[model samples]
Target chain A: SQELEQSPQSLIVQEGKNLTINCTSSKTLYGLYWYKQKYGEGLIFLMMLQKGGEEKSHEKITAKLDEKKQQSSLHITASQPSHAGIYLCGARRNRDDKIIFGKGTRLHILP
Target chain B: SQTIHQWPATLVQPVGSPLSLECTVEGTSNPNLYWYRQAAGRGLQLLFYSVGIGQISSEVPQNLSASRPQDRQFILSSKKLLLSDSGFYLCACSPSGYNEKLFFGSGTQLSVL
Candidate 1:
């Protein structure tokens, strides 16, 4: 079973539209991180949240960690064509544990 | 100012052949290293990880194995290759066990014939 689960496996939106990708964990998540990967490329580090109910932002993307750190969501505001990629959420129970990954959300921006 | 490097961007191998993939990190010492495999259009699957030299942990059981000989060098190898091993192999490292911001290498696309 996957420890981390992402919703809406794939999505499409017109340029400048907003979208959100959700992730949930079956176990308590001590650290939740988001990464983006273009097709056939390696993952690019995005953001990480440790404390419960923590929220972080990077340009047009905002991510929030729930109070229990059992769930998280990444919100893309005014998405651009460059934002098109597979978004993955990874979580670990603690620093020394293996990071479990979600299936990822594939987003395509309509030009 | 740390960077991770992986070589042979692409490789084609036959069954029952030997395999070796190397990864090294610069500008950092005693960092945690990891290897992951990704199928086409899928998420990353952890293959192996190491917290220090001579300390490799396997996340998934397979014909492959990993070794960490140096402080910042990790190697993934197999004596007998399998066609099911074809996929994009990635190498990553984190500053320590605390931060989840693991830096990744460009990756190697391996095709088994």
Candidate 2:
């Protein structure tokens, strides 16, 4: 079975609109990390969460990891065109450092 | 500070030709190196990983092979290129001895003609 799953494979929103993306895992995620990639480019690490009830933000983008460690959400507030890209969530279980990544969500921000 | 480099940013090879993709990391030692392939509009698929020099672990059964000759160097090769080899190839490194988040290279785009 796929270890990680992402919701709403594709999304489009007008600039300045708030949007959210979700990631769920079949197993508990000991560590969760998010990455963003632009077309024809490498993925850039966004943030990492190691605990339940953990929330981190970089500018307008914020991510939350529930205590259960089975799910996480990335919220973008007052989104902008620059936020348009593919977002991927990776999960590491227990102490194992090998991460399994979600299929990814393709986000499009229209001006 | 650490940086990963992959060469031949773009490649166009014909069927049955040999191929080689290289990846190197600097500013860090004993890093876990990985090779992955991403098909167009698809997610990343792990091909192989190595924890140390001369130690390679393959995650998928494919026509490709990987080698780690130096602590921070990894290579992906194929004796004969196949049409399925057309995709973006990425090299990633995690701090060795642990499961840290990966630092990826700029990636190489290969098109098999």
Candidate 3:
């Protein structure tokens, strides 16, 4: 069973600051996805990386996958209040090939 | 353009009660459907997934079960609910592939007392 571990269970940042959240997998990653969600809402897709050493960005948020495909990071530049949410990282498990998610990093942006 | 609809944004049930959650997708054919549960302070867990009608695969062994009766309809059912079942339920859909992006529903908050 493949498992994902996300760093910094929770984070608090002042508005206009920068922060980064990391997700590491127990096995080789086939695909990695980054999503944002409020406490009790559906997730909003942010980015998906399939190849090793792939990187993508949307607005002020950027995500990168290491060359080994075992680790991924999401970095937010110049954070704002709207960036406050639970950021989850999901990847396909090697055994079942079904997507599994990390515990997620709770982010709070202070206005 | 595809949209997913999940009913009864919230639900509260007693132990041993029956539970059913419905999810439907529009504007797509042969899309892969999935059911996920998010426990308090925990990440989303995949419970079930279906590639087509009447086909389902369970990820974890639990009191909950899922069925896909139609190409675009996915349902989660439980004969007897347990307090441990309290969590947030989400339905999502993606293209039939390993790397397609997932689109999630608004989610249903289930509290079993």
Best by TM-score: 3
Q: What share of the true interface contacts does candidate 3 keep?
A: 0.88
- Model 2 misplacement above 4 A: none
Considering TM-score, which of the candidate structures 1 and 3 is the better prediction for this target?
3
Per-model CA lDDT versus the true structure: 0.90, 0.89, 0.93
Per-residue lDDT tens digits for candidate 3, residues A19-111, read 999999968888899999987899999999988999999999999999999999999999999999999999975423777899999999998
Ranking by lDDT: 3, 1, 2
Worst 10 residues of 1 chain A by lDDT: A92-101
True contacts kept of each: 0.65, 0.42, 0.88
Quote the lDDT for B69 in model 1: 97
Ranking by DockQ: 3, 1, 2
Candidate 2 backbone clash number: 1
For model 2 the TM-score comes to 0.96
DockQ metric, candidate 1: 0.64
* RMSD (CA, Å), each prediction: 1.4, 1.3, 1.3
lDDT of 3 by residue, B69-112 (tens): 99999999999999999999999998777567789999999999
What would the per-residue lDDT of candidate 1 be over residues A8-95, giving only the tens digit for each residue? 8999999999999999987778799999998878899899999899999999999999998899999999999999999999988876
* Per-residue lDDT value at B63 in model 3: 100
